[model samples]
Target: MSALTGKVVALTGGVGGAKLARGLIECLAPDQLLIVANTGDDFNHLGLSISPDLDSVMYALADLNDPQRGWGLAGESWQAMDALQQLGGADWFKLGDRDIATHLQRSVRLREGASLSQVTRELCAALGIQHRLVPMTNDRVSTMITTEQGELAFQEYFVREQCAPAVSAFRFDGIELAQPLPELMDWLAAPDLEAIIVCPSNPFVSVDPILQLRGVRAAIQAATAPVVAVSPIVGGLAVKGPAAKMMKELNMPATATAVAQWYGELLDGLMIDVVDRELVDTIETKTRVLPTLMSDLESKVDLAQAAIDFARQLD
Candidate 1:
């Protein structure tokens, strides 16, 4: 895949999505790529605002995320968490000493009236990241999971409970009040826009929240750019996270083709791993068979480039 001619936009969440975003940053110039991060995982914890997916992408792009853990900062110490634990304070969510600084800055800036987009811009600059990063919306939107155990906040179900409870469905609390970021609307309307890539992220909790934002889906439908998605489900399992489990629990097959169906008409192209190539014939959307598991920088870059090529073919 050669260099793409115009601006590219990616809708992303945590971990897997962040890895692909890092790869895209390597391929596109600073002015050419825009990343819209999911804030549905945002929550208030221990008196600080925590935007998990935002920070995940931030850390991943900045080359600071812990490689072993796949979340939080590298070379981190947990003195703050240890102290908080000794004090018997709420510490189910481990906040690293270094990682706490990010939350502290974001929380204070937000409380002082800076929008999340503004704060994210500042944070990205501090880390020397040149690419543009935007939150899905500035207004409040929480991903609430309705489960066999009743309703729970996104982070509660994801982190605290370790996704133990079987999910029934998802509701984006405050979605009606949430508006799409103005830049997003403009990007969708931009005739020169090249592609809109949905990163290999959890569809239920990550990608869905961004799509469900007021008029985002309708705008994407109306956009001239091709919409491409890299299936998070490779084979019958998720590369990361509990997407596969959630799919089966929701009565959908946990396969790449099934993921294509989940996105349906929104996707002009679906990239599934070569392992699932046999199922390509079953999918209605134009599909690309490639190595979609991005374990390191090389593979991540390869997958990102493949996604770009697929998008171009769609056009």
Candidate 2:
């Protein structure tokens, strides 16, 4: 195979997205790739600044993530959380000892006037991560899940309630006031920018917060580069998280076709697992069939490589 060319931007959130992101990191040079992680899941818990999605990608890229749990550091000890629970502290959101250090430092840095991006850069450097990883924005825009029980923050719905409530709608609180870092805006308009890959993350919470920002969708629509997305839905279920459940609750099909339709005409191509290949003809946009389940490092790399090739073909 020939060497890959041009810069690529990947929008990612959660474990599945981070797995593919690690694959892209292996395939592309640090300078050629930029990873934009969703920060909508960020929240203040026990007075610590917690960025769940960003930490997921960061920990995965740094080789510190717990693969089995799909979040937090590997072999993480939870004495802190255990003690907190004993003391009647807020333990709904479990915080491992090492993971708490990360939040502690991040909170201190943010209070010291470093932007979230700057703090993230410092953390990445300490962890020896090279590829560019940035929060969707430094500004606070939170993902609010509206459930049958009423409104709840993302962590509350996901962790506390264990995603038991049926989702009725989602809102990005403070999104109207949020703005992308100037450089990201430039990337959207950069003439030489090659392709944009929307990683296989939850459409409602993970992906929407980034795209719902003012002018982001418009920028994507106006960009010349081909926009491609790897479908989070496979067969009639989500590979991870509540993407499929939310789809059903929102009166949409829990299939790759529905995923493709959700992205609509914005995508130049949509990548689906081979299990859903039979549904390709039902999709409107250009489509590719490949195994998307990242069971291991090699499979993740393969899917990342295929997505890039698909983008190059569309280009």
Per-candidate clash tally: 0, 0
The predictions' CA RMSDs to the true structure, in order, are: 1.0, 1.1
Q: Please give the range of 10 consecutive residues that has the lowest summed lDDT in model 1.
A: 1-10
Name the runs in model 1 displaced over 4 angstroms. none
lDDT of 1 by residue, 267-296 (tens): 999888999999999988998898888889
lDDT of each: 0.92, 0.90
Which stretches of candidate 2 lie above 4 Å from their native place? none
Candidate 2, poorest ten consecutive residues by summed lDDT: 1-10
Clashing pairs in 2: none
Candidate 1 residue pairs in clash (backbone atoms < 3 Å): none
- After TM-score superposition, the amount by which residue 138's alpha carbon in candidate 2 deviates from its true location, in angstroms, is 0.4
